[model samples]
Target: MRNNTGPYFIGNNTCMFSCWAPEKQKVTLRIVSPKERDIPMEKDDMGYFHVNVADIPPGAEYYFMLEGEKELLPDPASNFQPHGVHGASAVVNHHTFPWEDAAWKSIPLEDIVLYELHIGTFTEEGTFDAVIPRLDDLISTGINAIEIMPVAQFSGERNWGYDGVFLYAPHVTYGGPEGLKRLVNACHQKGIAVYLDVVYNHVGPEGNVLHRYAPYFTSRYKIPWGDAMNMDDRWADGVRDYISNNPLYWFEYYHIDGLRVDAIHTLYDSSAVSIWELINQKVKSLRETLGRPLYLIAESDLNSPRVTQQPIIGGMGFDAQWLDDFHHALYTLADSRGKRRYEDYGSMHQLAKAYTDGFVLSGEFVKFRKRRFGRSSAGVGGNHFVAFTQNHDQVGNRVKGERLSLLVDFERLKLVAGALFTAPYIPLLFMGEEYAEEAPFLFFCDHQNPELINATREGRKKEFADFRDEGEPADPFDRNTFLQCKLNWLARRQGRHAIMLRWYSELISLRKEHPALRSYNKDNIQAEVIEPGMLVIHRKSKDKNKVMVFLNFAEHDTTYRVPAGNVLWKKLIDSRDARWNTENIASAFLPSEITETNFVTVPAICIAIYTGAQ
Candidate 1:
């Protein structure tokens, strides 16, 4: 386990470098900068070659040369790659940062209002420091936690971060380790939790050199991004160690409150002890040692409760999983251009099912899967699921990468936001979603390999083969594709955008302040379809406080009977309220909360929230 974890140990201007190269007979440490030298590394019984070199200060660039190989390779566990992925790795001491978040107490997963943002497009400067001045804005929007996209070093400055080759190193372009540490410290100081997205299932094709040093990949299984990591293959102990240690590294060194583990279904670990089990145990132990909560949220495609279920019940003990089903059902039902996943969606019934039950396709026929998929998520607690109207994938994997705001009208946008906030689960807001930012989040990268670039273009073409009616997708290799995705923060103060932001802020306040709206207690929720394209959601707190959410997905106004017949209901929030949407000041919308209400008319694609204890 010694060499399976951190290989670089620096103290007193001396660094001990270790490389796992069992395939080579000799390994040499080659210092390229701050004076050049080549020192032979001694091999241990466990296939690890290590050497303790004096006068090798932190920030010095070095590389490893294998025996009989002419090319020098960067360390697989490099902490910083300042000169891109192919350049020599720089030594970084993590203790140099002055962290001021010792008294920072992170909230539980249920209370986390996660706002996911890519660091590059979040600000004009696109550095860690640039995101600091905007923290006050996020706080005002009621975002308590920010789940940053992967920041590990990738091939170039522009990437989704899933293509990162150096898992241990923070991207040099984003201010490197020091910049990330400062961001985390600042977030904790403002009582905000920082969650980092990490990719462990596969590595990027460009700038990837882990296979050169050790058995970091396996030929047994193929994943779309890159080779499947060698989780259960021969010599997989080191690979498991690598995957498990990454979370601890982020939590301990970077002061990250949680990790949004990306695409866990792609991991092929058939061993008795899977990588999930290994990482769960380690994080739990670390949680005890740190005396604070550490969230291990997974982004799994499988609707299996095993992701968040406890170990005793044959589950992975993760904190929660993203509920893509909720997004799929709601998107297809409301948006004009839905039905991408093909879970047999596009119905008000399915949206109601996603509200009452966690997954809409529980053992139901899926047109894409061509079989009955998923088990019932009936008794699962809402806190174990994270709900959203749109995420990075749902928006970016489109022909034009158009956001929901652009595809739907203003009322429908408010309806979608209402659906997400009222649900009994953790809510996540994609960056720019609060103000309905129409800028698309396109899939982009800056790989230097020509062959890889061609492959990427071809792959994107194949992905949207069925959706060619929308015109050809943006050229991902084009620099304009990356630049077009940057968020226009100034737009938040403008016309419709300002109104949407106010509506979202009101919904978030209602979700946090109202006891009936507390998340994760699914037993208090009851959703049913009242009419065609009309559904009513009834929620009650233990204190008898009640909230009724009326949604009309039809194109025209529709009438629906109230949850409690002939009873008085108080109007709490209306998407058409003069306070939020100024256009509805003198609108002719039906009064949903009458003193003796039986049924009331709701505008098309509108949402009205009523509260009262009958």
Candidate 2:
């Protein structure tokens, strides 16, 4: 059946309304504005109700009345919601917006330095237009792409966007569809690609009317958020099409360069062709048809290289997958408390493994899961893995959503950033991470349901029972919590923040300028543990250019002897330099030739980089 879901303008002062509600005996298109009337829709053979209403101009308000019921429900495929989620849907003319990014093209996957930001908390104003003026700052900071958290219409004005219900509409509070298009166009003009984070594993509890309209959810598998999406069950084609078309809609209409699929680990599908494969195939087809680059990045904890492998090779064809093991291993090494998933990490060897190999748990027995987890990602290219020391989940999901700046010392923080940029995988930085902003990224939501709000509060306390002694977690329902997560722009020009920002800029510059540092081939990289808290990494390019990174995690000064080799090396970056507020413990330039007897003194928590001919 041809799926013509949502409102489409058929000209002549008329709009054709169609909805996929197979179970409903009778569906009525109730127009609430420009002459209110209940127009009965005719059901086709495919169980879809559609009707063409005359003189129903653009921006008209309407709803779906199922089974002749008096209670009106929002459209299952609403294109715009002027009011909040509970209110009536608005008719949006998608063709009216003037876009200016005709010459824009997406950045290559290997060249991407992703900066993930939430639209609601990225700036003081917390709106799409507010983010426009800050694009220059991000571009200057060396980020080539910006990944926005979801903006799908949710319950209230304030949310992290994970609780979105109306998949097609941008949140009205965040400037809606027009606001998003403007942001994307502005980003394209500045050579920065925009990636949107989308959640499809489960529908949010509040404002979700999908279950009432169709067989959109399944009860076979239980997810942390709610019931699983019915991707392979009875009458599942419409649901699958609805979910898959969302990415296409964003790419085609919003001109989104890529999509970061959230929590694919929880997306349960038992079918001949998995939902992921179907989505990937559709994305590939779209990219081919458009003759432009469109990427699909998945957030999966499976630690399997096949997640990004091509379907032709018997794997799901994702462009890249988040390498969370790298973050866990690095976080554990930085702070040895072994909190949450950190329990599976914390060893220096694991950090070294993450540097040499993409995944630390490659077919290894996991003590936490009590089972063998992950297959070997041996043949996977480093560019296929997106690595980050801190992201929204790592920071916001915490008891207080404390950033890395609050958890570690300044020196250690610089060292972490240095390690991340020098690694062989694509790097992602959380918003305000470059400047070391002090504001936290707390998990806040504005739910109108009092019962859901109370349940959320109790649920948060129960989840953090292990860390209760750390202090009480901020209430997710509190408006103050949302306000506290906003970025402090003034802090960027202040003392320590300014220095950190400079350090990040310099690191990014180095990464971009050096061929060896830009190489993402894991086989060309080597890592070794010098001691308990000291490590060395060497990256080599195809052109015989090489770069060596030395890290000292110890609390005291230590002399690191050069490995057994005779080579001419030049010092590039020293975290302990006076420019970064650290004591100058090492010389700016090292000896041109280093023998077995050559040794360099490195301060505590310092990172040093040197370049040499391979």
Candidate 3:
């Protein structure tokens, strides 16, 4: 089957247009460019309407007229929407751009330290080109992979990119296709990989004309936004092909290194050969052909190890998955009153279990869902799970969109960062977190439809009704709400922010330098709750190098006995030191040695790292 389903140039001046509309009896290619003409398309055996027209130049706009309708519709697989989603689709020659990353190969998944950022709020300009100048700063901070929020064309200029309509086109407001290519090429040139977030659960409600083209949606299952994609129903081949080929298109044309698929749990596919497996097969083939490592990370809520298991074992082959259990455990432990869905995770035991087992609710009863959730990930490697202290949903879904910097003190924030970086799994840091930016990442959008605008406003208010005491949520439709989310890049070198940035950079450097810190083998790591609000983790590498991390989450200074049998332990990092800040000086002048007969003093809400050989 021909995988190129969009408009492509056959020669210099001729363009070939193809679309899958099995239900439409007659389809017409309406050219609205240099000359206006309607040409009838011939149907192939595979329910595709295609035609090769002569004298059609690049950058010409066109649309598909279905069933003799006077009103035309944009192509379902538009490569570049020069206007918005409702506007005409423009023909773009894919081979026109000059790429410079000829020898660029993505780093391995285990070695990746992902930094997630939304393009609209990441910079003042909020364009792809704006991100290029900041690449050196991120590289200096030890970030090797940048997981960008979705750029797929949505209804308006500003959105989280979750409610995207056109999956193939980049948002024009963010400089469109060429802008994205430039960013990816620049990242590769600096030894950084780019991973784009993609939404495949359901299309956006506004300007989504997929249902009009073919049976792209099914009534059997409905998502929170709309009907689920028709991945396993009758006449679903074209829909499946379209959805699966999107990542390949990005990797081939845009040169993206990986994809972070949004909400894979909502993709209800009951086929014998699941859509995920098919996508994995295709990606595997592409990896061999391209001779580069490409990754597929799933944002899955289901704690099934099969999500990252190999395809030969009756599993959906994915490289890694977002592990929310660690975040919930850490959040609930840090702030007892800040419970949204963390009903079952307030104890230090849960945090310890999350560190060692990778999941807190592995076949355990979950009070929030009133059922036993998650299966055991006993044999799963830790690199297959990506853990984070904060991400887009954790901050944006809150009533006030408050970041960790606002919820906890600098000491506790450093403690959490210490735990995250030392844990077995791969670590991901949200943008502005390393330097502790105070800007809130609120949920904002610019929907043209009044109904959608009202629905979004009311939906956010009702979603956090229980947290009314935190104050009323900001109006998502307001322009100020979007502007408030932009990061203050100039604040990184200021007081306290500069200290936090140095601490984070040092932590990342330590994690990368020590093989024991980056080892993902759960069996080689051990975690134990030493006291009421203190936990100690021991990570061991194959070379017999051991690093121990002590975390204190209490309100006062405490002393814990060190388990250094015969080896002398040296202090690596202390969050409460005077160099980091002067506010917490309980352990500022404490001794760095850890003796078997003596106890070490740990300040309130602080973390200390020690290295020794076992």
Candidate 4:
């Protein structure tokens, strides 16, 4: 299996172009840059056509011509699509980048506080270089890792990036390969790790020319996306290499520390070696050679069979996974406006169960699904799961793309952030969630086809009908839809927004600095419902340090007795600390410790943290 199948510079100003078209009788390499030169490609026995040509330097644009085809096709694995996805592929020399991150070593997965952001809406410039100046603010917020939404080339500029067609190319509008490399290098130098989100289940429908070149998709398995990939179908072996090489390309060329593989549930492979497993094995070998941490986090729920286990254990060997159950349970309680699938989550007890047990619905019957779902993840390490209250899917996929900050009160927002940080899993924050930005992260795209645009709008409205009281869901084709998602960075420095940012920063700091909060051992943590809309999470460190976090989701004050008849418990922080938020000023003067006899009245809709040596 080849690790590459694109234009590669073999010598100075000399390049070799490779294409996989076993069925084609005559495969021609048509270089359209510097000078129009058409070189008839010689096919090897293995179905790959290769030819080395001189004078084809970097930035040279090219396409492949198949026998009897009226139009030429871009390389299946083009590294740089200078124009849009339909444009000719530009040659990019991987060796040209002068990287200076030699001393860069990413932090452990267990210790990461991931901040997920979309490139188009992350800054006004909407380019990779624009994110460089914001690195300081991210680090100061206690984020060690930033997970970028997919930047793969799609139709036009604005997209959530799930519809990416060219797997290897970075979005041209986002400044392409060099821009991404510069961003990665800058992040590594600043002690920040960059993780890229990769979509491999299926390629985007528009500008997708893989069908013209080879058997890239199959109809054997049912998948939500138009066509399932040909992982276990004809030419499956070649397809595996093509899909597997994507992660390696990012790591080797762009210096990405991790990959968040999007939607593995759709990667259906009935072969002896599943495509997901094959990818894990390849990445593991690459990690060994590089002698660095390279995490593969699946965008699948814990229900997917053996997703986080090692290959030796008859598993897919993903390092971690995104657990949506935590988000559902917490979001349902905080925002009663949730619909459809959220009907399964309402009780605070479920959120508590999600905290203690890795999956609340573990092997249990799900009312929403009308069947048993999710094997028990009770034994899984908390580090094996990434938990958050909201992510891109939760926010951007909404009919209106309303952020959690907009749905809940200011105090409840603080409460949820505390819950996320203190929970026994790696925490993630969506862009501008730290400051509670008023702007929504709406679903958007800039597809060139008017027919596809009309279809997309209709499909979105139908999608919302399943779970929401539908008005016309935001008009995705509107340029305003894309522009509205841009983050208000200035808002972060003003009034309540600044306070919320500080609140998030402080919570993240405590999660990092405090021993009890840092430990991801679910066994050392106890999450229980104190009463309706009230919860308490007690954590103990291996070093005998103890912390108890009280979360009150109710709008009214609730009195509770400390379970442990404490001699002395040091109050570390309160979400409603009047000094920071300027609310509940009278209650801020409470003592350092309180016994079980003294009924502690937790402020309405507040989060309070306490610590003591156990």
Candidate 5:
């Protein structure tokens, strides 16, 4: 508790600064006070150095002085660096930041309608403070949780936040620690839970100095970025503890409600129960200790139910897992979309399967993998899965980074959104998706190394070889590409963008107001594949509240026979109200409401929500 990791009493200060520089000949404390003075450090038996100084306190600027040179070096384990990733570390006083959400409890994963946004691209300013003004938009739109892309310290000022090297530090360019505290506090004030994305698979390629200090990464297995963290080997306890503690730190320190673990499939673990089990165990313990809801959501392609099930039930006990099946299903259904991964989908059957059950590929043949894959979710709870139509991965990883709006018509896009929101699964919307932001979400990283940059470019080029005739694939390392990826706030105020924004707000309202709509029971869901181009989802509630969702994918009017159960039906929402109305929309619905009994007709490419008493 007394910062036992370091040892140091430096010049003119009582604060003891320390760093684990076991490989260095001589280590000094670089304090950015009167000047960048290099204070000599004393070594300990455990290969750590320390220097206690009287002048240093919270907000003091400093970095690990390697070899007595006062170079602008990043701290190997800095918690907050206000300058930059490669600059001096700033001391953050966690106690000093005011948190206003005392009565706040995290919304259950079952009730979470998540909006995943990259902070740098979410707003024009692209900083923590900049996101505060935009909270009303998300809160009003009905998002209960905002899943922020990674905030860890990476090399440059701007990044996707995935290529982070310093695990403990938040990015300086994004307003550092206090700024994040402010943003989280702002989010809590608006009743929106914050879920931070973390990368534990591998450290980013640049400014990674952890290997020089401790045995953080091992040679046992390699990941895309580098050697995976040794989670089941010697000194693995410390590594696990570091990651485990950081989640609670974000919760207890910054008041974040949850964490989205990035890419658990790449985490090489040889332990019997696996590394996921260990982390989920810790998550449960910490959540119990804090007397608040703490969620662990994993981004895994393994399709294993154990990733989200409770440990007591012979499972890992993670709160939720990202359901790629939902994304793929919607992606295929919305646009008849991509040729690359769309080979496995593009039918009403897959979308309907995803609506009723959680996954369509449960022990089924996956043409993408060219094999039978994915286990059945026999014991898995439907609430333990986060489903989405589009995420950063789907759009950003693509060659041109085109959203569904770029590929589909407005009617189909609305239908896709309605299906996702009304489905019996947790829903996530990518940033700018609420308003149908036309900007591309490109894969952009700021790498200092030329070889790394070239490799990234080459990787993108190779990935898009099938699309070579489509046009040139956008370079991933281009600065302009990243800048173009930023969200244009002006979109929300103009044209059909405002209408889409309202539609999202209305959908969120529907999801929150209707308990039947939020039910995660897989078997309780029923869908009628009325035709090849139209599907109707009947969400059955135990409370006797039945809601039927009609989706017409084709560009022509289709007639649907209302079930012969002697039920009186009411139209909840019709997408054609604004566009199809001859005079006023209100007058048009009144006549149809009185006459349309058991026979209802659906307009082309529109989704309508209907509730009835049977």
Candidate 6:
């Protein structure tokens, strides 16, 4: 293991050093400079040694001492380490950074169009400050919130940042805690709300030292990784406080707008009272103190109402949940392919159910589970759910890790994109999907253990036994896998990819312009299956604004009749043309461009949007 060696500064010239060295009978702080000096430390009750150095300053280098062994180790809870992950901890003066977003306001989650991106894969440079330049791109796309993947501190130089051990510390490999602060400040200045995805279910399998000094993990319930977080077990109050304080720290110290709770289904708690309520209380308290509307989003498979229901209704106070059923239905229906999770979906009925009830599998027999599963959320508001046609897990967990572009034709991709933007729910897009970038989003980690690495490879093989022959599996720990996932900035300006990017930008613009297209009320939304390969979604607003969306998934044209109504219709937007040109699709129609009985032929795998004339 690498040790930190520094004349480092921590809280002025005098600094404190503490680390858990249970394996060593004796430990010494070896100052390997000028004249080698051995400094002894007093072991605390938690098997950690602590001593304060009187001569160290802000940029000094240092390391730890262990049982006659000399190794430099960084502070286990380092706020900043400019040298390396294994180098001396540097003191970060947080008050020094000049902030210009003092009047920065937060956009409520109810009115947000979120865009989820992994900072490492979002740009070629893959750093916090590097992502600052792309704020204009997101703002132009009409995205109100940016949900970054986990930034928690993890071991090694590169990772997804989920296996973080230091709950309060940002990853040292990615410019540490201060870098994240700068990013958040910059985002606030650009009027973009920053929401970070956090992993509280389980820590990663690396330099996780929390188990040594605190009861952070429990053996009572088994999670995907090692041990489950001790949410409700013995000595858990402190643990819960630690976990809850983490988000508060982010919101208070870092000025983050909200947090996306990762995979809440695995957050097992055998307590009689709801543990979700406890978290909600903590969030409420923090929001009161911060004087801002803080938000929480849960990614759960269970169709339990408690996840999104209001606290006054004896439910958890999460603002929204990730609606995966919508994606699965859209995936199964649009591509006409999917065997695993999509096995129970793809019917126009299921798609209709998803649009009306929020979840298609609500208490229905699902072929994939071989059991009746989920509950219908019929009366819920669409704004209480986040829907996407494709996401990080759907695209990255595949054997080949190819996005929708690899499985289906390009037309189908555009059709799904149209559905995503114009749907009743809040829409989100995965990175690079707007321009149709071909690079795959594969699982890439920087694990040091060889056995763990081999097990990861084998586990992936077993998980995709039925789908393995599609393509070769890329090693998740390989540096090349991470490199390949980076977005090709030039792809947005070349050929068909550029056309796809423009189409996305235009659809988003239209959605923002038309209130009828973006209403979140389920009652205001209606859809009908015209045929096996065609469906139409109609949205009606109180302002007498109404729009109809036609989606054709077959490889041949399908003619759709306008509903029998008392008003004329006018074309609004169509995804058939190379650039969504409304000039022809809007100006000409079979029935003089304004008739209740006009029939229009929707091209193969195309989408058309039309509005009722005022």
- Winner by lDDT: 3
For candidate 4, write residues 1-614 as lDDT tens digits: 23446767765888888888878889998889979988999888878889889987889999999999869788889989998888899888888799999888788898888999999999999999999999999998888899999999999989999999999999999999999999999999999999999999988878999988888888888687777899998887778878988888888889999999999888888888788778888888888888898999998844754899887777888998998989988888777776455777788888888888777787777888898888878788889999998899999887778898888888788888988988889899899998888899999998888889888988898888875654568888899989999999999998888888888899888888899998878888888777767898889888888898888888777777777545457788887667557453545333567654567888788888888763
Q: TM-score for every candidate vs. truth?
A: 0.96, 0.96, 0.98, 0.97, 0.90, 0.87
TM-score attained by model 2: 0.96
In the range 106-133, model 6's lDDT, one tens digit per residue, is 9867677788888888887788878889
- Candidates' C-alpha lDDT: 0.86, 0.86, 0.88, 0.86, 0.76, 0.74
Model 4 Cα displacement at 67 (Å)?
A: 0.7
Backbone collisions counted per model: 0, 0, 0, 0, 16, 19
Per-residue lDDT tens digits of candidate 3, residues 238-260? 98888998888888889999999
Looking at model 2, residue 222 earns an lDDT score of 81
Residue pairs whose backbone atoms clash in candidate 1: none
**Model 6 / residue 578 / CA error / Å:** 4.5
Deviation in Å, model 1, residue 200 alpha carbon:
0.5
The number of the candidate with the highest TM-score is 3
Kindly list the per-residue Cα lDDT of model 2 for residues 487-589, writing each as its tens digit: 9988888888988999999999999989889998889988878776888888889888888888788877767777755666788888877788744344243
Give lDDT: candidate 5, residue 612: 63
Model 1's lDDT to the true fold? 0.86
Which rank order by TM-score, best down to worst? 3, 4, 1, 2, 5, 6
